[model samples]
Each structure stands twice: as structure tokens, then as C-alpha cells.
Target: MQIEQQAAIVTGGASGLGAATARALAARGAKVAVLDRNADGAAALAREIGADGQAIGIGCDITDTASVLAALDAARAAHGSARLLLNVAGIGTAKRIVGKDGAPAPLEDFERVVRVNLVGTYNVTRLVVAEMVKLAPLADGERGVVVNTASVAAFDGQVGQEAYAASKGGIVGMTLPLARDLAQFGVRVCTIAPGLFLTPLMAELPQAVQESLAASIPFPKRLGKPEEFAQLAAAIIENPALNGEVIRLDGALRLPPR
Candidate 1:
């Protein structure tokens, strides 16, 4: 579907990949709603995108039904029902199932990661699709599209990444099923499993560490840019045939076991 003049909702829009996507969508003439847990950051980015009301920012916790409902309501009120939903809000953890001290990992930690990454993604998608289905189909018989974020760790999980890997793996697992379920409604689903990239969290590491991570990629030996991710997302939306696929944005990099 043409992104121009469409309403788009991007979760985790306050920063990182989500921020880049919001900006990209807005640039393509989509009225964007930046939903994030960071209220101030979200509002700030919205202001940066456009002061003429082309975008809005709402504080949202995708894991909470009430929060998501309120966010969707506000978004619809401001920009009409969203035709594009980008699920990018997620968290990571680095804890071994059996720690060095020979203790089991905290169950809460695993639950939190899965809750935010997998379950939270589903929560937002379900709510957004509910409204998207009500809208009249476009010329292509498409009502909406959803793009979810995963990680290469899902497939190449290293030591201490059990929680993060499992959570992202769930996203990878659900892509095709989600597409099939939403086919009748003309909503497509896809996923992106990104490798090491310079996100806000990654940037916090020392320069040497960052460079080391970048060197692991086989080609274009540098970190993936957020704009590159945004470009792919926009591409997925435009290409009607691309559905239920998980494309890796990692410069041909296969992560090593840590």
C-alpha cells in the first residue's frame, strides 16, 4: 500500500529503530503516532517530526491491555485508524540459565523479556488489526500491514542470551501464522531479525567493544544503520507480495557462539 497520507502507528518510537521508522514514515507523508513508554521522549520526537500536527506521541505500554487500548484510541482520534503497525518495543537480558554460581536464572527475568518482546508484540498487533479490518480495503484489497522486530539471537543465541533469544524466537515463529490468520482481512504480517547494530543500548558500550562487534559482520564491515531498517520496513509495506517472511538485516553476518 502507498504510505502517503496513511495513518501509521510505531511502537518504541521514542528512540532507536522505532524513532528512525517514525521519521521515515512521516517523511513519506504518513500521519504517524509515536507510541512509547517514554512519554517525554515520544512527545519530543513528535515535535521534532512536525509541529503542524502531522504526528502525535502517546505513552504506551504494549504489555498492558488498558495502555494499548488508550493509545490506540488516542491515535485514532488524532490520525484515524492506523493502517500500518510497527512493533519495535522490546527488551534484552544476558543471564545464563545456570549462572557461574550454579544458581538457576530468575524466572521473572525470562518472563519479562518474553512478555515485552513476544506477548507485547501480539497485544498491539491484535488491537490494531481489529480497527484496521473495519476500514475499507484499498485498491489492492489490503487493509493494513504489520512489521515486527526480532533479533539474529533468536537463531544464533549465544551464552547468557537465553531469555532474549527465546523471546525473539517466538516472534520469528509467529510470522507466518499471523499472516495466515489475517489473510482474510487483507492484513499482511512480516518480521525483521536484525544483527548487531548501533542502537542506544549498544552505543553505551566502549568504543573498542562497539568496533569489535562491527568487525564481526562479513561485509560492509560496519554497524547497521537505523535508516536502513526503516527503508526495509517501508519496502515491506509497499511490496504486497512480501508476507509472512522474516528478513535478516545483518550484512550476511552469522553470530558466533559466545
Candidate 2:
């Protein structure tokens, strides 16, 4: 879909990869809604984007039906129904299945991760997709596209990452199934599994730890920039035939188990 003047929804848009994507989408002329749990942060970004009609930021909880619906209502009220949905909201808290003392991890811990990452992605997707099919297809019966964020951990699954990895793996596992389910409506689904990135928090780590992480990447020997992820998302949006695929944006790096 041509991004210019189109409406797009980006969850987790208050910071990290989501923030970068929201900015990139707006730069391309798409009126964007920045959906995030950080109400103040989201509002700040909307102001920064100069609500000159280009963006609106709404506080949203991806796992709650009422919250998400309210967010969508606010976004639609600001822009029109969105034709592009970017599922970037997720949590990455880590915990091992068993503690060093040998006690099993709490089930709620695992469930929370799954609920926020996998189920959250689906919650927003279902609502946005419903609105998408109502839109008149852009030429060739193409109505919309969904871009989901997964993580390289889904494949490598280092120790202490059971909850986080399981959540992401669920996203990778469902890409094709989601695409197939929405095919009849001309809405496509795709996923991106990114490697380590230099987000603000990561940038605050000690230099030695940062260097060690950078050295692990196969090529470029560095953590990824948020803009790089956004660029790939923009490319996927513009390409009509790219669907049901999970592209690894890890610079050819396959992580070793910790």
C-alpha cells in the first residue's frame, strides 16, 4: 500500500522499535496512531509529530479488550480506519524454568509473558483486521498488511529466556496461519525476528558488556539501530506480494545457546 496519507496503527509506539516505526511511517506521509501504555509518552510523541493532523498517540493495553477498543476508537477518530497495523507491543522479561535452588518457575510468570507478547499481538490484530476488511481494496484486491515483531531469541532461546522465547516463538509459529486466515480478505501478515538492538536501556549498559554483545553478531559486529528495523517494515508495507514469511533481521547471526 502507498503509505502517503494512509492511516496506520503502531502499538508500543512510545519507545524502542515501535517509536522508530511510528516516526518512519509518519515521515512517509502516513497519518499514524502511536498506541502505547505510556500515556504521557504517547501524548508527547503526538505533540512532537505536531498534531497538524499527522499523528495521535493513545494509551493502550494490548491484552485488554476494552482498552484496545478504546484506543482504536480514539485512533479512528483522529485518522480514519487503519490499513496498516504494526504489532510492536511486547514485554521481554526473562526467567528460567527452574531456579538455581531447583524450584520451578511460577506459572503466572510464564503466562504473563505469553499474554503480553503472543496474545497481545493477536488481540490488536483481530480488531484492526476487522476494520481492514471494511476498507475498499487498493488496486489488485490488496486491502491491508500486518507487520509483527518477533525476536531472534525465538530461534536461539538462550538459557533464562524460556518465557520470552516462548512468547516470540509463538509469533513466528503463527505468521503463516494468520496470513492464510486473512487471505480471503486481501490482508497479508508477516513477521520479523530481530537480533540485539541498541535501545536506550541497552545503551546504558557498561561498555564491557556492550562490547561483548556487539562482538557476538556475525557481521558488522554491532547492535542494530531502531531505524534499520523501521526501514525493513516500510519495505514490507510497500511490497504487495511479501506475505506469510518471517524475515530474520539479524545480520546473518545465529546465536549460540547460553
All models: lDDT? 0.95, 0.92
Write the residue-wise lDDT of candidate 1 on 86-181 in tens digits.
Answer: 999999989989988999999999999999999999999999998899899999899999999999999999989999999999999999999999
Cα lDDT tens digits for candidate 2, 1-258: 788888999999999899999999999999999999998888888777745879998999999999999999999998989999999889988778889899999999999999999999999999999999989988879899999999999999898899999999999999999999999999999999999898877888998999999999988899999999999999999998899999999988888887
Q: Where in model 1 is the C-alpha error above 4 Å?
A: none
**Worst ten in a row by lDDT for model 2:** 44-53
| Cand. 1 Cα-lDDT | 0.95
Please give the TM-score that candidate 1 achieves against the real structure. 0.99
Each candidate's TM vs. the true structure? 0.99, 0.98
Q: TM-score: which candidate is best?
A: 1
True lDDT of residue 35, candidate 2: 94
